[model samples]
Target: MENLNRSMKLSLEFGLSGAVLLPVIYEVYANISTSIGLFLVAAFACFAGVKFSALKFREAFVGITCTIAYSGILGWVCYLFIHPRVVDMLLKRSVYFSLDIRQQLYFLLYCFIILACIYLIWLVRFGLHKAMEKFKSNSEKTGSYIENAFDDGKDDENL
Candidate 1:
């Protein structure tokens, strides 16, 4: 139960972050190139969530996946429901885009790409984590040959 709560919190944090950014970026550009901005937000949120969180391997990935999907949904909701004009305009846009099979396929391709990116993020984060642990272990085994001035008056046994 604790793990689930933590996982949900993590998901909400990153999901909201990306969700908040997506529409603003889309609103600002309102063009196809805005896709790049959305992708950047997704990558940033994923990478940050993966690298910074202390959750285990499976949990981290689960949270990140949830975050991605949740954010996409929330961003759409925000973009559409924010204003009546936007709701109508975006509905029209969606209808126009939905008629194209190619665009639908492209959407699937983008989903696959997002998953691939999350996997890669996990790989890099896991590698760095292992490397840091190894470095700390090795460092602990090796110490300075000379004592510092702070230990000058300390002795192992005097009585």
Candidate 2:
């Protein structure tokens, strides 16, 4: 039950983050390519997922997946409905392009790569944290040994 609740919370966090950020980012960079804008949206979604989940890798992954799914749905809706109207209003002209299968594939590929990179970064950070812990422990041991040696030398001199 607790796990279910946690998952739901994470999913909502991801979905909302993706949904809200996508439009804002597109509005800000109106002239940018769709792919670049989506990439930025994905990056922010990932960041928000990780941040809001208390930096838990598994939870962040769940969040990211939810974010992508929600964003895709919202994007499709916008493309089908909101986009044409906005374009018509702004340009007073209609533009049409045939669907390019390659572009769709490339977009998916890029999204996969971005997600993979984020996970890799998390792994590296975890590794560095472990390494720092080991180094700190070794340094403490060395410090204690040096202090013990100094104490022994003082004892010998007093004797």
Q: Which candidate number maximizes lDDT?
A: 1
Give candidate 2's error at residue 14 in angstroms.
3.4
Off by over 4 Å in 1: 1-3, 29-43, 50-53, 83-116, 141-159
Give candidate 1's total backbone clashes.
0
Task: Count clashes in each candidate, considering only residues at least 3 apart in sequence or on different chains.
Answer: 0, 0
lDDT for each of the candidates? 0.62, 0.58
lDDT: worst 10-residue window of model 1: 95-104
Q: For residues 34-103, write the lDDT of model 1, one tens digit per residue.
A: 4774576556656755653566777777777787787788867875654345446777876312225665
Q: Clashes in model 1: which pairs?
A: none
Tens digit of lDDT per residue, candidate 2, span 1-159? Answer: 455457557667656555555544443335446757676856764575444344455655665566567765765655565555555654664333323677556555665566445455556665676789899999999999988877766777887
